[model samples]
Target: MKQPSIARLPRMLKLVLTRRAGFGVRLALVGAVFTLIAGFGEASAQAQTQLALKFKAGDTYQQKVTTRTISGGEVAGEQVKTTLQQEMLISTKVESLTEEGAGNLSQVIEQITLDIGLPKGKSIAYDSNQKEFSDPILASLHKTLGKLAGARFEFTTTTSGEILNFKMPAALTEMAKNQPGGGMMGDSLSEANLRRMFEDAGVSLPKEPVKKGDSWTRKASVKLPIGEVTSHLVFTYDGPENDTLERIVVSGDVEIAPAEKSPLSVKLNSTKLTGLTFFDRNLGRVDSSSMSQVLNVTVAAGGQTNDLTIESQVEMKIVPPKK
Candidate 1:
């Protein structure tokens, strides 16, 4: 008997493919997450000593980025590229000081305007920008912030029209707590779990450690629907006291399939960080700085190998809090 076509495969096989596709997209998104957190962490760690680093106060920063996406394996046909120039303004106001460290931040606001340039033959066009794009985006933001804690505003314009909205989500408040390097559970982990894990790791952050080449590593098993995935995260610090986070590297293998599923696997071997900068607490501005990283991803299925490359850069201005 002849083998059946892939389209005629069993439901279970189809489900496997669907899951793999979703996993691929998640992997790509993970790269972006790494970039954001790595940069955020370096800056936050360096600025930890800055006076009055409390909530209910506002600050603004500017970031410029140049990123490129390259794909192979199943995604070989598509080429993705974008250049982003943007500004971010953040403000906070304490609504009620219920307790010394536990008060409600009533007004938390963020304003972002980005100029996005897409590659030829690929463009984003929409009518009723507010209804089509702004609403959903804002809703997600608000849900992410909730009743108190985090808020944001996004406005975008094309030659065609404009987009504007606001959102507040409580989860953002939690994420902000880990600002810079907290991973997946940074936003959702309970305080008790966080403390327990920190203690288990024997992690002790100094008020000020002599700035030098410092590195830390962690290994953990993450439970997924398919199976348990082992993850390893490595953080590296390279910078003088003036600027911190010279580099960061993360490498790990995630089990994409089990004994019954297809013999497939996904591996992420990426080193995402090159240069970083710290905000001048007194100056309230992004000190001049730059960062770069190269990432490689490999996927194996049915004895076939697919690979991809991602390169990214981040440059930003440190500005003072509004008066």
Candidate 2:
């Protein structure tokens, strides 16, 4: 799977991978995950559970997302290796229901933590809950990443989990603007871009109900650190994982979007993506999901070429409201 190069990616994405000023920009990408979960379902009605997403006003849940990514390659005749680990806790509440039965949702980032491993054994760590930072870089990042802990967004979705509208807080955009290499963060966070991301990455539900062993295909265009990748995914309803949960399995292959001309050129050596999702039938919502993705890319830019391999694992879990 060969595709476009990193140069085709948004400036914000480039900064995160190559410059220290990119942490805050990464937050915008993380924030996008909230909407991704809402796009997870579409199944046949032949099963005991309808598979349609449902929400009730006053209902609340907490989602915890953990991601670990590792990238290694060579640039300018020097070996470069980096690893990023991020964890975020998001709280979601159903504020109201529209006449058309859409769920008006309010979401807030309650906490976040990051650990980055740079070349030469150097590392940077930050936790929104921590008060002290021994490293200047970490301290500077705190000024911006700290603010993300309480950032909020609002959106509306239909019963089947289709997004109708979404709003990004102005404060968040401002925070990004203040960071280094952040000039383009605002553009990526704009309503149009966010909507495009949603539409490209989202998984559509089937028009009608489906039974166990049934499967459907979803085409997703995902934005990676390198560039946008279009994937062909087959999602299968694997029936019940347990009495309380239904299972869905996803398998996919990705290809980089081609570019006509650019300073950078990319060759995707190999790639793989897979996921497993558990839906809480009793709650009519997702209980948990996990994904694994790996890509091997050779990028040429500035008269230099680097063979980079990226591996990422993401886990998302929803905690039920306390009685």
Candidate 3:
């Protein structure tokens, strides 16, 4: 073969080297993109299996709650019955969190409405937003309920949603401050009951990761007009129901416990509680929740006993983050 020129040799080698380098760079870029996508998919799968609150600061939830109670059995061989209904608007925010994942939250009441049926075909309704009411008693109660608006309460909880500490306010006392007979409804709005109403409804996660059919138990002592009630809240994991949501089922029982001696006592009572919640892993919170309770109770007072049954329901959902 004839000898080639030295200048042409250098150009030929340069072209070959440049082509190899470019091919390697393109291969590396493709691999990096694939790795990133695979990592994202793996993280999502892990989240669905893991059970924990893992709350972020400043997250907020809006809740609508409704409660209906009908308590009627027999008093002195006469049938007696009454129905009570209540609706509320509540907002919950995670104020701050601890290194161990515990969190402090601020719960605010925005609105409240109530309807109570009285004897002899009489019924009264109270709406805090109403400017005027026909009955003075209803008007007074409306004004009392107004105090709840803009009320903020701070508390701490475990990742599982169990209430660790509650800054319970003198709710009934505050609601009754300017009312004519604050004392009559004061006990019915006691701090203990209100605290449980907000806290116990929280999502209680399992100690360990759970799959379908897994179950756990939680116990709480709540005070109500019928008396102090100790309840056992049972939780069941139905596992991952869909791409973004996890389903949890709840059922519980409440029993009258020995409490302070007072006319406010339950002679006999039956209780049942059921609930379901859907959690969004990507959002890191419950998307929506619904819970209901039924109570059939016999209330005893000075020389008399009254039968009562009550049904209560609550639903909640996370709202978009504040700007």
Candidate 4:
């Protein structure tokens, strides 16, 4: 088998780092996203219900998440489209509980597969489970993200699922430090970045108990590799779906601003985000959640402009442990 040209490796790596780094961030903190959305209602609500996350020592759960992003438009007056898809398996365990009932949680990525499809049907694919790569781009991605498999992140969160403190694995920091743009990558992996991406994007439960038909809105801004995004989400509690699960409806709008001191600038022409979460009060976990986002933006880089329409769909589901 003829190997891909070595000359293309640099451009490929840059493209992955610049355009898809947010997916890496998502892979890192997807567990927290699930946990936060899972604690929507307590089991004991008649007219009003308090929301809290419950965890038991030694309890463990798994989540399977799939995300797909498609962007199409013109780059430098040339038409282009790119599609990225990722599938990940993550495991979360309750290491212990605080005196206040908060959980000391640990999450690890078990498996991951990423595929990026570009115009003309050219594509790059990587799987952490794959051992050998004939293509240089796949080998590079394998070195960067493949190292993430089994990397553990530990954190403490309140009963409401608000993160208090987080610890990034030393290997991850070292991994970023070894990358081409190590400084920027390292900063992007900092606690501040993690919190902004994970916490700000998380579902913030109501401060007080909420009855059926109650609705609240939360606003947050988070920095991503693409840019800084401000989101406005309105959540409506639709009450219980059945005896065990509560359903919440989510809809939102998002706007993007270019990151300071970056060559890439993004102007959002229009954006929308919508989702639904099913929380199982009896299981104390979110059984399933799905979200979709569409962003229409003009990206300026190297004195050229790319008008793109990006659409993303994310679905997460809890995986039951083997008996």
If scored against the real structure, what TM-score would every candidate get?
0.38, 0.72, 0.70, 0.77
What are the lDDT scores of the predictions, listed in order? 0.39, 0.73, 0.71, 0.75
Error of 4 at 78 (Å): 4.3
Q: Which RMSD values do the candidates have, in order?
A: 26.0, 22.3, 13.2, 22.8
Give the per-residue lDDT of model 3 (tens digit) for 53-154: 766788777776666666566777777667788877778888999887888888888778888897668888877777677887876676556667667777
Evaluation by lDDT, superior candidate among 1 and 2: 2
The TM-score of candidate 2 is 0.72
| Candidate 3: residue 251 Cα off by (Å) | 1.6
Worst 10-residue lDDT window for candidate 3 reads: 179-188
- Please tell me which predicted candidate would have the highest TM-score against the true structure: 4
Q: Candidate 4: RMSD over Cα atoms?
A: 22.8
Per-residue accuracy of model 1 over 1-323 as CA lDDT, tens digit each: 99878697555455555564677776665566567768988987755232112223232333322233333334445555555443434343334332333223322333434444566644332222122245554444333233222243222111111111223344544655654323322333333332232122211122233234455555544333223444444434444344432222233333323323424465666545455444333433334445455557676666666675656554444345555
Query: Between prediction 2 and prediction 4, which has the larger TM-score?
Result: 4
Candidate 4 C-alpha lDDT tens digits along 30-147: 5454454455334344468776678899998888888899989977668888999998888888999999988898878788899999899898888898988999888766776677
By TM-score, the better pick of 3 and 4 is 4
What's the best-to-worst order under lDDT? Answer: 4, 2, 3, 1
What's the lDDT of the predicted structure labeled candidate 2?
A: 0.73
Candidate 2 wrong stretches, greater than 4 Å: 1-49, 74-80, 130-136, 139-144, 173-188, 192-204, 220-226, 258-264, 320-323
Q: What lDDT score goes with residue 276 in model 3?
A: 93
